[model samples]
Target chain A: MLNPIEWSSGPDGEIPFGTPFPFSVPFALASPESPGLYLEGVRRIKERGGRLVSLWGSWTSGADPAVLAAFSDAEGLLLYRFRLSADDRSFPSIAFLFPLANRLERAVRDLYGWDPAGLSDQRPWLDHGLWDGPPMVPQDASFQRSPEGADSPQEEYPFVRVEGEGVHEIPVGPIHAGIIEPGHFRFQVVGEKLLRMEERFGFAHKGVRTLFRNRSVSDAARLAGRVSGDSAVAFQTAFSDAVEVATGSPPPRRALWIRSILLERERIANHLGDLGALGNDAGFGFGSVQFGRLKEEFLRTNARIFGHRYLMDTVVPGGVAGDLGRQELALLREECARTKSDVLELKTIYDEHGGLQDRFSGTGWLDPMLAGRWGLGGVAGRASGQMYDLRHSHPVPPYDQVHVPVSISRLGDVSARVQVRFQEVRHSLSFLDSVLEALPEGPFFIQPEETFSPFEGVGWVEGWRGEVLCWVRLGSGGTVLDAHCHDPSWLLWPALEQTVPGNLVADFPLINKSFNLSYSGHDL
Target chain B: MHKILLKIFRTGTLTEPLPEPGPPVKPCPLVRGSLAVRHVDAGSCNACELELHAFTQAFYAPESIGIRFVASPRHADVLLVTGPVTLAMKDALRAAHEAMPDPRYVIALGDCACNGGIFRGSYAVSGGVPEVIPVDGQIPGCPPEPKRILAYLEQLVSAENKD
Candidate 1:
């Protein structure tokens, strides 16, 4: 069950840390727990086998800057708010306990200069020394980067060196050969075999924290949707859920169901694309063409029904942007059924093909132990024997009524990921069918209050990749004070780094495509 | 292989003719019938990249129209840049342009590439493609659809000489 957020109170009845602050989603609060207490809280959560979902710092106006960590459990999403004094330079590091926290901790350091105490890996993660310093405090509108700030990271970055006979380094991209987001990969290899695949991302950091500040709810939602364009619906849903929680405005049941429909459609479309891409990466261009055509047709249908290709901005703050008529719902159901059977045929081809099977069966294997240790979940996690699914584990709102089947595989390779995607597409299709069977009727959107008192809330949804969280703190007059949108890619990127070694270097693309982790989402 | 061939044969080509450019579309000065383009994602959110990939998929089959997305900038005649130019990517964008051979044209894709788009005033982004490298033309939209993108590219496809 969800552990209640521990919030203490001062003598004057101000919420100082036992006073429970209510959150609109699943419910939790922010109390600046001391370092010792914070450590104790995190230890308890870890003991309970809670997975670290997201970790970010928030500095709202008129309040002490605080660092927060989100942990997922049976109860829902539990939060830990650790208070940081102005003089404090570091906080207790959970990276030692949770390996996935390592990169996020480094990101916090780059953005807020708050280093995780007692952590050994001090290499900068998100910051490339492109800016003057950590962007913790917002700069003036006219702030400028120093002339020398543009020094090439290729010249300065210390990619962990490997010294041995026949060990050579192949540095690839911040700009890749194909049309994908930018991120550098430093592969230490012996001939065609990979020794280690170290990555340096953050090439797509468009300053989410800087952009989220002082923006209206609608503007913030739009920005969140753009965080990772592929998962636009998920990001906006989480963003909207966060604001609705903070502002105490909940959408009608009808909107919630519609939001889920959009989410499932988005899932189906993405998985369809990935199915083809995974095939293409393995030199099976035929699979790419077949799936790509299917996905394009699906997206075209979405444009006709939802008025947007990626379903961007469709899930707004209070409710959906627009309600679907009976005709649109019928159209969606027809498309879902068609795509489901289309994928089943491809699945047969994948299963029966010897060459594709040979290349995919055991390539880029990730063991179950590593997946669990790093708290990997979603498609990749399911492929690696981690069976946790947010829709099943912790059902939020309409999900409680809609049962979502978790498709899992233990093989933990490129093929396993492919299998998981295919199954998930089927699962989403059934879930979508069930959702559309009976349409609820009510006001789709309820306008939020024009102004709001300073309040912090969090919302998360199980996106196609994995679960994504958006933490928001509203300032006076309904403007955003601080916000952080954490993508599941943050956790998977490191998990992916572990999957590549000992595999042939050529299989890297196949492995990477199978997971298809988001470079832009993680960088943001 | 026969089953695969049968499957491929059953699913006929879905490729369509490129949409004709509107009147405001200008002809590029470069004399070319085909384009060998290189893509550099300066700092895109990946939406534009997604559409670009869609443009190359079976539904579009851009190669049938003589458009090839080359691997290296050195082999490119046109540079397709996406997203707002981030500070980290600015040098790389400029470097990619410098690497391209003479008479190389730059086409900024998406609203972000055109003028920084949604992430305009952020500290990390240094505006759009024009800020880092000279841009010959731009395709606009949050992410211009594949049809719209092909129409924009079609403007540069001259009927004169073959590469």
Candidate 2:
């Protein structure tokens, strides 16, 4: 049973325990009062096993430093920020309490140069050999600019140096030979048994956060849709949710149902594709081809039913940018029916394939304790007995009406991840049928009544990968202050290092593909 | 009979390679027969690979239009790329692309593949495909849907066909 949240000045400026879930605070602590009270509050929450969802902060000109200082009291949490304001101003680092705050603080420090006190680590994250001058100082703001050629210091990033005998390095690509994205991996291995693997991301960091500063909300939503292309519906939904929360506007009922349907389809498409890839990795060509063909068929049907195969830009704030007609719905239902039968048949074949099971079963194991520590979510965390699903945790919209049973496994291995995905596909397929059958009718969008000016909006959606959180802030005249979208990959990537520990280097692909955390999603 | 059907299904019969277009562009032995390629996003939002994925799922199926996506890039002549190349994947993508051997072609999947899309200026981004290595063809889209992606791939093949 979940504990009730107490009423107080909750973190993120929310009225403590905003919606009476349950802890009644004995007393209140003001910003001017002892900051230790806030620290104590976090400790109490942690002791009660309340996992950190996310931390949000802003630097308004009139914002009090006292309120900011109070944030340092919370222990053991991570702040997922996409950008920082130019001023060397930011809330105190929560890293003292949350070890995950290490990278986030470094990220904030890199962008805004406000070094939070008491951080365990303070190395630059995204600015690897890239920027010169004061990073991310808002466009019209002024600050002490770095001297000429000051950017040169970024070349030799002080990455953690690896040492020890029998630990030879295997340097892999900033330039890979594949059709995928670019990232460099320096693996320190002892004859294929890996010792340590260091990753250098941001090679593809396209400045998504800073680019949002001047864009309109509509355009920003479109940009958000592209933040990680495969999860377009999920990103847009999260973006829309944040906008809705800020503006206090609810998307129309029809729009909500349509969004849910699109989200389900997206989830199914990815699961099918990943299933095929997993089979391929295990050398089960039969499973790979079968799943691949099914995925192809499903995607083709989607393109026929929806305008795009991946359902891009179909979801927008206020409501979905588009809708599905009856004929399309009927055809989709027919396709779903076919897919269900085909997948059931294929599953039998996969089960009987002993060769495939060997590589998949115990390949990469991530324990539940580690998952909780890293705040892992989505399929990655679900497979490890961490029963946190956004659809249930924060019941929003159409999902609130339906009981979405999340599938979980405590195995935390490659097979466990695959099994969870399979279970989710079955659930998603059933949910799709129900959604289509009881499709609601209403306006696709409702004109929002509340106007937002220079306010921050936090939007979250349970994406196919897991929880996709987006933060949108607007400045005076409705210009974007900052737009940050945090992908579950942020937590999952670190877990990969732990999972691959006992596994062979050759088995990395199968393990990695099973988890398949997003490079673009996390990089942004 | 069922087992036979399963066997045949698993084999995925290779379509007879399209005869080398009469007198390939100039004296190029490198521009070999038809190729089918399959592109996987792994975890993209569908902005980049969606375009390529769209190419196959849409009415055209890239192959029907002369540019195909095989289940493996090993069978592919052109490897289309996209997304702000991720951190964990720089090697995987390269290994897959390099596994194609000689006379291979590389296409930047989208703006993200071209210059990391909206993420072009991000910390976790590695810029475009070229930043990692040389890219032959470039297609720009926040994600260009299948029709557009097919058009681009077709143009590349036809251009190669002519040359």
Candidate 3:
């Protein structure tokens, strides 16, 4: 029912809008009219029931500054591209329409030196003043060491103040007590009740985007896998998908099935760890020990079946690197069955446990409307009644063969998040079994051509956390011109900010653990 | 309750035998005691943290070998550092290292901390731990497994004892 129409161009140049494919549609706009067209395009997508996935900017040496935005719609994905001339470096902000665009715009400004003119929170997002200038400027090599004395006199971050009677501010670390990534959180509190929570990330930003430039497609896949360690499989697959699409090479069917298997395994392993951590934060040590043991078992299985415990480097551009034999398949089948039953029992125990219920239910509530407005996805979104899953909604290759039942709840609290994870673990187990059962017969990998024509490709995968969208533009001979890998954490991080208010200070950890947005993923 | 207790009993203890210590390197009393580690993630993909978390889990219980993670660097005898040191986290890493008491050993876990791994020369990163703080030992791998980490700790402790 939603009609797709092309945008008109001005005197500058006509924007090229590619034909919509089954998976993704690619379009481009010129600098002169991009501000109006970009806003109109975003509005049209939302009108057509699409949500923004990610928005990023890239700076290449020869080409003009480029901005790419991805949105998920009922049909598939809508990718909007805008090219800005050297003379004109500003674009009207879309943050007013989409609140999630605030951080993305800030990152674009800090990294590529592009100005999003109308952005609300123009305060520096990732630029902690640790460096001298915009790193991604084409003239300056983005990876050089800072000037002498640049390290001294760290810049003070201006956190928004909420002043009132009995109001106090609590600042938590860039270095936490647990073995986790570094991220600072500033909480405005009146007694135990949280008035507001502001998050400052980028302690883990290692200039991953800068490293992606000029690398070969194969080499860049490895960097993509490490974008976020937990979502390594998803990130690698998405990167490979983009490269493959750009090069016009579809991987072998068997390779697709194997990639799905690895993705499901990664999902199960992370869910087990999170469920255990959530229980532990709620004062249930038994749950932690038991679930921790189960996760260890799963990781061991990954090592035995695939080469790496984290399944890193198993998915390459052409296809996957590893294959499962009969013995491995049998072992996995038995393990999957066992894990499912055990997890079911654990879920039952959690539901019956009164103390955990008291801690989980109604804590860190995220309203469904807020979740939709923010375009939240993955487990967090599903818990909040957003039934959008890339696996189910946008079924690519192997996922089309196997049905992925979306597990959604309306509670939008810690309890709902836990329940959604529980349901997903079970669903992933079943999905794995089906894929392994229908494991096709073919080569695990196909060699890609040595050189590829200049083209752009978009890859989207539903990682355990949520949808991870990757965009790659390959020049002649497979040289990467620009690559933007956007993690789902970008959208969910702000949602965590919203959920923390009205909850007690003591419940912050539990609420935080429930969302568990990847600081490294977001920071990157 | 009984079922849960039975599940624990059936699982049994997951303690693994520690590797044989190398000959003592010097006459240091600190080597005789257990090693307490304070972990700092300068900038990593968190794959190393996953392996480290697994090291504390039941399977490769590092505690059985006198290696346990502490909350504070002051209580720590060893600083277990992971990831390529990002510019934002460099100061924090230095502060954590300075907070540690003397007789401290810095162990760079995973390839990132050893020599920046894949993220070397990144715009926001200053390579590895040694770029900011001195490292006493290095464990290599995209993420070295739990057993590998424990073995490295054993060797460090043994060599210190010899001294």
Q: Pick the candidate with the highest DockQ.
A: 1
Q: lDDT for model 2, on a 0 to 1 scale?
A: 0.63
Arrange candidates, best DockQ first: 1, 3, 2
TM-score ranking from best to worst? 1, 3, 2
Give the alpha carbon lDDT tens digit for every residue of A164-237 in model 3: 89999999889888798999999999989999999988799899988988898889999999999999999999
Candidate 3 TM-score, true structure as reference: 0.93
The residue-level lDDT of candidate 1 at B154 comes to 69
TM-score of predicted structure 2: 0.80
10 residues in a row with least lDDT, candidate 2 chain B: B20-29
Docking quality of model 1: it rates as: high
Fraction of true A-B contacts recovered by candidate 2:
0.29
Q: What are the per-residue Cα lDDT tens digits for candidate 2 across A138-221?
A: 544455542221233455545555678876777765544333444566677778786666666655555567667677778888
Q: What is the lDDT of candidate 1?
A: 0.82
Q: Mind giving the per-residue lDDT tens digits that candidate 1 earns over A147-191?
A: 222223435677788899999999998888988889999999999
